[model samples]
Target: MTQAENERRGNVPPSNKRYFYRTYGLTIASQLELPELPKAEATSQPDVVVLTPGVAEKLEGATFRKGWLEMGDDRCQITIEGVARYRVEDGQRILLDRRVPREVDPVADPGDIRLFLLGSALGGLLHQRHWLPLHVSALKTPSGVWAFTGHSGAGKSTIGAWLHYTQNWPLVTDDVAVIKPHEDIPYLHPGPPRVKLWKDALAALGIQTEGLVRDLTREDKYHLMLNKGFQDHPSPLKALVMLERAEEGEAASLERIRGVEAFKSVMATLYRPEMGTEFNTAEQLMRESIKLAGKIRVYRFRRPWSLDQMNSSIEPLLHEIKQ
Candidate 1:
């Protein structure tokens, strides 16, 4: 192991599980601590074992297993009858897990860690949906894949809810959305399709969902999974909206943008980058992720927003693309 890595693994107790923390994508939030996943024995030394701070209490009699995550989701349980054995594998690689891989960074935080996890998973099972540099939420509308980008308090939920209920569109992602750009073609992958709306918005839409709203940091926001209607829709992206509330009477204008200006705007909504982030390289990436006319555009919307206004505003843009 490198000296830097050893230093990071420092103070990790062999007998404790204190919420292992790491950051991915953007930056760590100044003050947000989350729980760590439980531990399970491995039959073989992991090819890339990440020694996170873990709770010391062993599950009554948990036994080690091979080619699996430590005591995977509840279904992966075994009685601890014997010692678990594992040997590290050769030709394995461990990544530092950067959100913007080639970009520069100072440190990693919990949010960044989450981004890293998603990025790592992108290669294995989620490869088909790997496109663009994205946040957690990506909504699916009847027209195409819709992504809302902005900093916290920018009213993404408000805009998203208005789009769905007022306009009758479906949610793709509430917190995160990945945009996968095709290598040989001009297309982005469809990451997660769902969104979280504020409680008032849910009520306004008259959705009868029952669950623990406590998980939400925003009392107004409720997580939503896209309906089956989006299951077979086109996977390529449609638009990237930077949602922000304006004073009453402010005109909601849709503008086309490119480059670094675009990157910074998109970075704001991402869950990772708790520490916050900025980009010097944005134009090409931003353009590549969404179709110039049909897929991507920026809208400075005003209050009294509704589905009708959204559709009316967006229809012209969509028609432009069709032509």
Candidate 2:
């Protein structure tokens, strides 16, 4: 029967058993089985609950309305054209509305939905819960968790993939670094045990992408799931390494950032800084940023852009972390 007919006859039933998963230090019970996240033990009370697909209601009294997004005091609605509409409320609940006409099979067709679920929706929820999410890929070392933050194509994931695959360092998270603020030291929560690597990166790392899952948005990028070497718990954040492209043929250097420059650099790494402004006060963000800057050491690492220098580029960071 057609999907439309199934819907019309009320034959598309939601899953009877909710799936429990964990990421970024939160337990989630989701109607959809998200294989991208690590499975968690069943819990009666989860930190977040993801409901089944349903009609999305208009956010009442939305204070911020822009292209494809609406935000209120405690709720956010994100409409991705031709994909799905998501509602994240009070940092606890998430509701999905499928925009595509395909059959409702969460397991088989969860790539696109899971992408946004872990991206914009989760980012919004984190902001609401007062956690700082930075755009970084992290790996756990003997000292502590080291996070790499930089612009796109700055080799964050490539470096991370190299270390995880070659050096046996456990990957903490990829793409988004979740920070739980504290007085003495902030903590970094582990995210999904996957790294999205471009084709060239995979080749550079001597990895075969035959069975790897392709990224939904990037045609040339594939998701590499680390089943073995993955940090699955929260760890005290050690340092922030900011990667920058150095002049061709110039030697790589690592230097410490201090005072105002450190604070500004940390602020620049915020994964959705606008969400912080919308869901939280400027004073709140400032306070957290200041706390993070004061507590953590931020290092600026400049390296040549060539792939040949990838190993040499990581040397400076590895040496610095050992100190």
Candidate 3:
């Protein structure tokens, strides 16, 4: 019988295994094991639950549609053409619907499902919960947690990896940096323990890509889990450094930004900013951004982008952080 038929007839056998994971300050109870996230003790009532694959359901009265995503107030439906369909509801549950048959696709190779689950689905859930998710890589230092943010290919991951591998800073999070809303100080929550790097970035760090899990969407990129330098707890926000590529032969520079520009910079780093609009969360996000701008320091760091100058470019930022 086909997968859909089995679901229709209620013939799908329930798996006995259960997994618990912690990420973005939330405890998750899932039917599938997520190797990217650090394991947590099982909880009777987790903050989120990821259900096993079953029948797909249509979302009613979706207010926004963009590409493969449909978003409403408390629910989101994401359809990846050939892979799977995911529904995130009320900031608490995730329902998976695999497009491919089970016989054709084994459970062992769940990279595609994991990719969207951790990326788009989780982002939507964060929106539902009213947390600020920034597109940045972050690390915890003695002072506090510092984050790097910029446009894609702007060296956020590269700098973050360099600092972790060479400087021995514990990695707090990668890709999506979750900030809990607060009245006084902004706190960053730890995310999945893995970092995604391109082949060239790995080579620049003198690390081999063998045995690394390839990113399902990008063949040249791979996910590397930090076994030793992973921080799994929330930390107070320190500073946010915005990276910009400098002209050839130009020296690296770091300058502190304040007031309106700082607020705009933080707003620009939002993960899936359109979700704020669709969920009618723009005003709250703006208020939080303003609070974040007032509480933390923001800096613009301009440096050369070549791999050869990676160390020289990063040193000044480290020195500035120490000051």
Candidate 4:
């Protein structure tokens, strides 16, 4: 798009001071550059544009959904009620508006709200754009990328952080892994290099939190930016591991899942999956899931929630992957 066109679309105050960023296989141009993301070389035509709040006129019947998100055919709005509101349109533009209360601490950083948008709000945008976003954290192995996925508090990020810190593996992405099937092989795109972990996970990994920053939404969780051993490029997806908590008598074990069971597990990890229904991506994702199940090995990884059990399970998991 051109400068005049951007202004007409409610992308405000177009200036030459554009910050370009690449993540999840798309280029973004914005005025306020995110410190957490690596900068991309300047691009003339960006895939997504970010602007200050201007385009959002109240949609008459928009009601808040389960995750404080509302969506229509071509647009979505995220409202943090008293904190901020964001609208993404046509999967191409995002506009943010903040609503801080008078009682908030004066020293509180406003950037935290933007970071929140970058998480769930950005995932909504990717879903609208028809990208398959998985609730996964991945590591780079000599074979390829191995993705660990499960429900919240299933230790995906914790395991990813542990592997990166102790095993010297590169973290490909944290929280969301945007994937695409190319030439019969699924590829995992790189996201932000930082891994978010709870305080308990940090303690288990022997990480000091003296200088760490807490997650904006979850105070107990913190962010750890991987300065070294961070992968910025997409890699072929080699394996999928579905993390599950071990039952009382169960020991930590990795077992293969096949056919329909593998497909169901992969489907469960998709980010903001409800939005995929509105965008008609369910069938597409289903096809991709089946193809992935057929081509790659999938495993059910069970472990007790203790740090010692988690540590012990790693070697066996690695051995299974080697086979």
lDDT of each model, Cα atoms only?
Answer: 0.39, 0.82, 0.82, 0.76
Candidate 4 yields a Cα-based lDDT of 0.76
**By TM-score, is 1 or 3 better?**
3
List where candidate 4 sits over 4 angstroms from the true fold. Answer: 1-16, 55-57, 60-67, 99-108, 181-184
Question: Candidate 1: TM-score?
Answer: 0.46
- Which segments of model 3 are wrong by more than 4 Å? 1-11, 55-58, 100-108
Clash number by candidate, in order: 61, 0, 0, 0
Predicted candidate 4 versus true structure: per-residue lDDT over 161-236, tens digit per residue: 8887877888998878787655455888877778899998889888898988887678899987775688988888
Error of 4 at 33 (Å): 1.7
C-alpha lDDT (0 to 100) for residue 240 of candidate 2: 89
lDDT of 1 by residue, 2-83 (tens): 5333333433223222222222111111111232221223323332333233222232233433332223212121111121
